[model samples]
Structures are given as C-alpha cells and as structure tokens.
Target: MRNITVEEFRASCAAAQQLEIVERKGMGHPDSICDAVMDNISVRLSEEYLQEFGEILHHNIDKCLLVAGEVTGIFGGGMVTHPMLLVIGDRATFSAEGKDIDVNSIAVDTAGRWFDENLRFVEPEFLDYQVELKPGSAELTDIFRRKEKMLGSNDTSAAVGYAPLSFTEKMVLDTEKYLNSPDFKEKYPESGEDIKVMGVRKDSDLDLTVAMPVVDRFLDSEEHYFRVKEDLTDAINTFIADYVEENKVSMDVTFSLNNLDMPGRGMNGIYTTVTGTSAEDADCGQVGRGNRVNGIIPLNRPVSSEAAAGKNPVSHVGKIYNALSHRIADRIYTAVPDVEEAYVWLLSDIGAPIDRPKVAAAQIIMKKGSVESVQDEVTEVIDRELENIGEFTMELARGMVPLY
Candidate 1:
C-alpha cells in the first residue's frame, strides 16, 4: 500500500482527440490463434498441476511459433498440401517430488482442444504439433515453494493498463465480433474466421476497413464471390448504422470489406481460403503478436510490451499486473464520478509478494475535482484489487479472464 500513488493525469484522452487509430485481430487470426492456444494450454497445465501437486508450480509458457502451411484453392474448394505447424516452447514444472508431469501431452492436447473450440472449420488433424517445454530454473521454481503467504513474483516486470475504450477501439472490436459471431456466420457461411478490423477516426467521421477471407468451399465462381461480398458489405453497413444510433454516437462511419480485390485476376487477388482461417496457407502466427490483454491493440495510448497469455498466472507479474491494472482503472473511473479516464501502472520486483508491487500508480483525468478530492477513492480501488490478488489469480488460472 505504501507504493500506491494517485495523481492527476495531464495528457488528453484519446477519445477526445481528433485523430485516432485502432485495430482488433479476430480469434481466427494466426497471431490470435497462437495466443489463445498457448493461453489455453497454460490453463490446462495449471489445472493438472493443481490436481497433482496441490499447487501450481513455476512456469512461463508464453513462447510459441506458428509456421504457415501449403495450400491451393480454386473457386469451389481448396486442398491443403501441408499442415500448419504449431511449435509450443517454454518452461514448466516437469518433475516435482520425483514425479514427472506430462507437460508435452497436456500442451499438445490443449492446443488441439483450443482449435476445436475456437475455429469452426480448422481441425487438429490439419495441424502439426511440436512441444518444447522444459523444467524451469531452480531459482524461479523456488518462488512457489516460499514460506510467504503469497507466491513471490517470478520476474521483475512492469505492466500498464487504461480504462474506457476509445470510440474507434470499441468500433473495431465490435465490428470483428459481429462479423465472427455465430449468427452472422450462419447467414454468411463463406466468411472466414481470420477477420481483422482497422478503424481510422478523424474528428467525427470514422473509416473502418475489414479483412474477411471467404472459405473457398462455399463459392462456385468469381461472380458468386462478388455477389456474396456485396451482400456482406451491405449487411455490415446496416449493423454499423444500428450500432451508431443505439450507442447515440454522433460520429459518421464508413465501412469497407476486403480491400484486396482484382475481379479479372482470377483467384490470384481474391481473399479465399480452405479452412475458415488463413492459417491453412496464407499466414503464420506467434504468441504475444496478437491482441493485448484488453483485447484491442490501442496504438495511441500507453501500452506494455509484455504478453500476458501463457505466462504463469500465479507469480508472473506480466500476466497478473497487466490485467489487474485495467481492473483498477475501470473501478476508479466507474466509482468516482469526477474521473473521466483512469490509467494504472504496476511494476514488480522479483521474489516480492504479488499483491504488493514496487510501484502501484494511478493517473486520473478528472472531470470536475482535483487530485486531493478523489485521492482516497482512487487509492482504495487499487488497494482493494491488490488485496484480492489471490481470487484474481484463481480466475486467471481457471481461464475466466481474457488475456488477448
């Protein structure tokens, strides 16, 4: 608590600014796949550790690589000549008390399970697996065995988070979610899962460019593809209009789908894939290269480079502090009427208790009051979140929180 500090935020919020940009990679994006799969693997590994050892042993399993596969597609269907390779590499508690943990089996199995759940068309049979997990260093492993009430921090790391998504950020996120939603997919079955939303807002007008690849199996010809594309575009426009009016946003939005189109170029320029994901052939993915913990990649705001997914949920400050900071910032903005926006930063020292960070700071953009007026409320928010660190870690362990 001594390290906690709250102050007036001097910088202008991105929402109030004139020019802003935001991007959200859908769950089927190669990078998102890596992040989600590895994170799910960590969760499964944590559960196994809990069931076997009565506690989660030390591990940091964030490293992952997704190698692209070979495929050829025509107007009707596609063939996968080679499967995508998923290389999961990281540290884990392999042996404890002379008993070995089946880390590789858990990692490979979780990756398959994740693919089965997230991507509608992609299957584990289409993926190649490689697990490179090894036991963590003794120094880091000993942190979990400490006599302290809480597990000591695994590494000296810093994480920052901010509250209140910007208008462009929300629009990008919402657009991707809408396109990938089951209802939308049921109506437009050709749409691929590897969707990306890019939003550019200048003043009140916003331009949204979406990349949604179509599954080749659903298309009969180029003409049919164009017709479906037009229908999808019109449908998205209708959704955006409803979204704008429902949210009471005065901003004018223009939406575009799949900018890469050359009608006469055969299938050379068309964004079509075999599976619902580009991972079948077009692209590759890696952990931490996708979305941030908050889900949207905010380019204008302060961001932490540390990736939360796949990290040990117990003592990895990278995962815990990044998520907790957002929770703290959101709580402060919601609880204090005078606060317009809030940003929280947390820095940890190795071997220190997870609840007590070396620097727990909050920056508030006040609407009507000075720093002293809402200091107690803001500090209480941070203190309360830190005090409940155990419950928060359990949620992370159980995969209840979103890391990407």
Candidate 2:
C-alpha cells in the first residue's frame, strides 16, 4: 500500500482576485520549439526502447538549445544566410548487449520531422546539416545502472499543480489554442504558429497582448503586413467578445498585437520573420524556458519550477509528479461542486517508489463553507490517483498527454 496524504487549507482563488496575469507561449515560440523537439525525440526514443528492450531505458534529453540563424527578407521572400543550429544534449542508453541504437539518427530525424510538420515556413532540408547530438556524461549515465525494471525516482524534487482555472487563465489558454487551431490557420494563412498570449486583469477589465509571427512569404509588401495584422486583431477581439458574453462575465476587454512596432515603420516592424519564427534571425531558445506543465504562467499563483519535458517518464518525479499533481487537482475540483479552486503539491525522494510520495498536500478554497464536508472525498481521489501513477509512463510514451 502507498502512503500518501492530502490536506485542505484556506487560500483565495484567482478568480476572486482583483488583478491577475497569465502567459502562454504557443508551439512555434523558440523555447516552445525546443521543448517540442526534445519531447518528440524523447517519445520516439521511448517507443524504440520499449520495442527492443521491453521497457524504456534511462534517458533525459531535456537540455536542448536552439541557436538563431541569420536571415534577411523583404515582404515577399527571404533567404537563410546562416542555418539555425540545434544541439541535443543529455544522457541516454544508446547500446545494450553489444547491439547499438543510433541515437543521433533518431534525434536528427525527429527534429526534421517535427519542424516540417509543426512550422509552416521551416523546411526539413534547412536543418539537416545544422542539428548535432552530444553524448551523455559518464557520471550521469551511471545513474541508470542501478535500476533496470521497476524504475526509482531519478531526483528528489517537488511538483505543484492547480485546477479550476480562473477566467483570465482560461482566456489566456484559449486564445493561444484558437490562434493555433486549424480553422484560424486556414483563415489567416499569413499567421505563424510562434504565438504568445499575455493576459492582464485589472478590476473588471481584461487586456490581452498577442504576439504572432508573420511569414515573409505570405506578405507582399508593408500594406499587406498591416492588413494581416488588422485581420488577426479583429478575429481575436471578436472571439474575446463572444467568450465574455457567453460566460456572462461583466468585464471590459481589449486586445493588442505586437506593440513593439516602430513609430515610422508601422506594422512592418512588428514580429515578422523569415521562417515564420523569431528563431530565424533574432532569438535563441532552450528547453524549459517557456510555459509550465499546465501550459500557462500565472505570475501571481503558486507554481513549480520543474521542467517536465524530455525527462524519463518511468521514474523522473519531476515529470510524473507534475502530471499526477495536475490530474489529481483536476479530478478533485470536478468531483467537488463547491470547490472554487484546488491546488496539489507532491514531493519525492530520490530512489524511492514513485507511488509512495514523501508528501502529498492539497489546498482548496471553498466557494462557501469549510473543507470538512468534502475532505474525505478529496482524499479518496488523491489516493486513487497515486495508486495508478504507474500507468502514466505508457500514457506518456503513447503521447496521450503533454509534459509541458
């Protein structure tokens, strides 16, 4: 039997607050790009390992870096003066029983496929010569030798998650999804996936700042760039207006698109890039630099710093516990009708069984009344979740859930 504890405490819910801020970096953002690439590689490696070795071997390919390339462009077209560089770092089991697994080939191919499938302007050929893989350090690789079958915790870490998202949080998350949705992409073909949605709530008013990259190939001139910006702004505000009205939330809403425009250059000076992402010429990226496990950065709320992507799903508490915490909170929040918000914290000791966490604390804010009424039910849910956490590895390997 696993020993886990759940407790309820008093705390104000974000929805009841007067001010809030939330941020989400979309899939094409450089840091998110790095995250997606590493995640894909890890998932692929896990699949291959399971097929050959009967289970995933120890691997943590989380330390990935994206070095920006040089490019220059007009409204209609651009050329890659220097190719973007991707470095795949961290340790993995590349060979076993004298049989070799081509880890480099797996990583490079995954990078190409991810870019080609995810980013509209980036072609796989452009990245073929630029991606490089570095082998894992001997010291870190030694850590995997201790556990082969039922894996133990890789590190002692804490993870936090919450549920029943606030109005602003939903707005921020939805905005990013809406922009990246196929329907929105079809309507605004010029828009790139490198979208960032920032939300601020002051009193009853909500303000949103969205940064979307415009593909140079889609814009013919400065006039067309401005037109595309206008269309996107209109589409987003329209969506916000509908959402606010449907939710019956009496709030004022405003939308701003890339305010970094120069005074004279206008919309052309906004966040346009050659390859539909700032990574082409301006920005660099690293894994874990963007969004948390919940996909939103709530500046005023409690959050864990653990980067869930690329960590070994079998035993890394940083990845499994974070996902478990979120699922637990969501389950409790859904089961308890009066619970306005639910927050869960989980801690693990290195080499310990994952099902038996060191600490499992839950905090809930009721809409009206005390936790005594729902305490037992919430505890049951947490216990059940912890017992079933072992199944999460397969879920992750199958890509049923996102680590970040």
> For each candidate, what is the lDDT?
0.89, 0.82
**Alpha carbon lDDT of residue 310, candidate 2?**
84
What lDDT tens digits, residue by residue, belong to model 1 across residues 106-203? 89888888888878777666899988888888788888887678888988999899988877888898889999899998899889999999899999
TM-score of the candidate numbered 2? 0.94
- Ten-residue stretch with the least lDDT total in model 2: 125-134
RMSD of 1: 1.0
Shift of residue 304 alpha carbon in model 2, Å: 1.3
* Tens-digit lDDT track of model 2 for 107-205: 888888989888888876456334344556565455556655456677899998899788899899889999998899989888888889999999888
The lowest-lDDT stretch of 10 consecutive residues in candidate 1 is 117-126
lDDT of 2 at 250: 84
TM-score of each: 0.98, 0.94
